[model samples]
Target: AKYRINAFHELSERASQTYTTKQMTMEGVGEASRLGSKIINCKDVSYFWEGGCLLKEFSYNFQRFDKVEIVGRNGVGKSTFLDLLTGVLQPSSGVIERGESLVIGYYRQEGMDFTGDDTVLDIVGDTRLLGRFLFPHDMLNTRVSRLSGGEKRRLYLLTILMKNPNLLILDEPTNDLDIVTLNILEEYLKEYGGSLIIVSHDRHFLDRVVDHLLVFCGEGIVKDFIGSFSEYRSYMRDYESAKKKDSIASIKPQSSAKPEKKAEDKPRKLSFNQKRELESIESRLPELEEKKAAIEKDMNSGALPYDKLKEAAELFKQVSNEIDELETRWLELQN
Candidate 1:
């Protein structure tokens, strides 16, 4: 009799849980259906600053069905594109057309600021939504000021969803988020019936979230590819490989006499400046890289005091820029 009662109770609990899940699922569907998007249209858009070109003559229609992932190698100004999209920085030329009833929710790399004393419940005013985002009941009464950086980032995401914006812009959204949180966030984004734009280096995240790409192919050119991130990468790789193969196939066998002439034409000594640069570049690059890594480690380690963090960050950026310049010079020297 006792065993039968226990089994019945377990089954009853599961049925109750299932009923609650059904309710939530229904609510989610209803919420998604109510959502919409704004048509943010860009025409002949270009951005240039400090006598350097970033993007030139780019065009796109950002709408509900479009999930655009901005991709570029570092220093190509993906952030500038984001600024253009969000109206933070006006384009150097061209027109940006926004929808009449557009609402934007932008999640930048920086964490959200929460001032004064406030509980988690006070912030969102709903625990079930928080639970959906991996916040448990124990975390409800926690003070806003006491939350960790990741927690704050997660909360900011939840807040964004709760407000139900018609357009969302995320820049490096996965930087500090845990995998579990990222999974849940991706799930939420899947059901989101709104326009979305993201700038991310996370391949997995890009593969899952975005359907189209705005690629910065260097030299102020942006290629709008109608495919996922993986597809674009595959296409580029295949193109490069075929190009290399064609070059190799085009090379005819050089005569022994031609080889001797080529050897004679080769310079016996590099210029004084070139020699000095070649000698020091190999050592200088490693030092700059080491300094960069050490600064990153200290920043991540939380060892630097709050006031010094900004200084460290600036120094790190300077060192990184130096490394990039030096590496480019080194490659030229090698060539």
Candidate 2:
């Protein structure tokens, strides 16, 4: 624990140095561009909760008209980092500094702050630019709760765009959005001139929108690479390869390093309800697989009747959906 604390402190120091260097670099670059002169700066930022570390020693700088993508697996502190950037969550340590003229527009993943009574049109109307772009002309009267998931996402984006902020921070912007809406968002962001820091798992969307990548690995490590998603993937592959080779070369003739002791000795136990659900899922999986195979066989066979084929296709779809839902539930129980 003490060594971990010291490592974190060292990382914080390094982040602070990086932050200072970025600040000086931006100042030297001069600001009189068409996209506005403001720069968004994040200094040695660290956040933790209930003795669990979320973000550790993170720092990045965004200049006018730059688009940066934040990438990492789930629970890697991407959302937490965004919250800190937008002043929603205070960092456990370090500081964040923004330019005096900077304005920030943020879109969160939860969609919680929106009121149900407000129609989609009314919400969009409040963000005049978004209303124009999304529901142009008298369409602002639609109720928010009545809109589809994709429509709600568009409305949310429009609201943030209305602020005309020099910097935008989007957290998991593509999750649950339909493909059509995702394309529209890509088009809009391509033309957007302001700085952007977007967190997303959609690799295609990231490739379309961002020129740089920032990754928080959930350790005390943060990685920054300039280029697209494809480039990031290549870098990661090479890095992993090098790490593997080094690990192999360092192997001792005697034995490998002992595995570290886990904090909890006992394995987590599932409740009766959870065990029942898991068993139910396990029971249905074989049936679902069998049904899926039968449907595929029917569809492939030339002698199958048209009505039978259609029925098989529909049944297959339903079975697949149910299987997906059941698997998600099972995973939740295990976790």
Candidate 3:
């Protein structure tokens, strides 16, 4: 009788434990369904510009994801879409639904302003939780007025992070960030558990961080693709090729209305200063490439100590900035 009673008690305990686990799982799923689904929902969304349609019947469902990237050419309403989602701008006509527990941290392309008299340290320190990934220093006393544009960008990122948000909406997050900070931010996002939606022109960064892509094309149409930037490009190329072939096959042969226009090619010309700038950029490119190669070598060989690696990484960032600046100047000269 004693043995039978003990067996019965063990079964009862097991049953109770299973019931508790099931209940907890059900509660978690309920919460996720309520809070993580449909982070940004738009149906028949439209926005108009002067005598033109910026967005026409754009619609998509952006749910919680590890990372999402928004891509498009300039003036395609990418920023406007973000603004509409964040309530910065009201849509002309559409319904947008945000989850109840969704808290958003937005980083705009332009700089953000902190309270006057706030020191860099104070601004950064106040956002320690978010800043820790990038700053990792006690900067509470550093005055914002003294901070550089890059520093300000970092601080803004930290401020958004400090809010402990469920969703992160970054607009051109890489615009002014140093390469080191950008890499650090990438690492953090890779490990972050919450949802992320970002707009960036940095192709490499998008390739590394985002698992999904949202493209805003003119005419109020948003395209969704479930892959990285490279994948999206590949898909786009294939689609265009197929479309071209189909069009060619469907066209009926007809006489040309006017003389066939010959494709004209012209020799490119550059001014003296422009040529010099291009030369300067070209000269610097190899040096940066060499430095990058050296860092990779050191990392591969395990010859760099932790401190040395960190220093090298910082130098790499500086070089990258110099390269970008030079390239930008060169492009302007070409234009």
Per-candidate Cα lDDT values, in order, are: 0.68, 0.63, 0.63
Off by over 4 Å in 2: 1-38, 112-120, 126-138, 243-335
Q: Write the per-residue lDDT of candidate 1 for residues 223-262, one digit (tens) a residue.
A: 5555676576456445445554654554558665476655
TM-score of 1: 0.64
**Error of model 3, residue 28, in angstroms:** 11
State in Å the error of residue 308, model 1. 34
TM-score per candidate:
0.64, 0.61, 0.64
lDDT: worst 10-residue window of model 3: 1-10
The root-mean-square deviation over C-alpha atoms between each candidate and the true structure, in angstroms, is 16.6, 10.5, 15.7
Residue 314 lDDT (model 1): 73
Q: Residue by residue across 1-335, what tens digits does model 3's lDDT show?
A: 01122211222123112111112232222112224554666667777777677777666655554477876666668888888889888878877778777788788876487775787666654544535555545555667777788887788887777675667889988877765677778877765556678987565667787876666655665655557865665564454455546545544466553333211111234667766766676677667757765764565566778898878767765765665565345434432
Candidate 2, residues 219-329, lDDT tens digits: the string is 645766567765655554454455546555655576455444221322345678876776787687668767766765666676768787667766755765675566445
- Candidate 2 residue 224 Cα shift, in angstroms, is 1.0
Whole-model lDDT, model 3: 0.63
Clashing pairs in 2: 119-143, 119-144, 120-143, 120-144, 121-140
Residue 27 in candidate 2, Cα distance off native in Å: 17
Question: In model 1, what is the error at residue 67, expressed in angstroms?
Answer: 1.4
Count of residue pairs whose backbone atoms collide, per candidate: 0, 5, 11
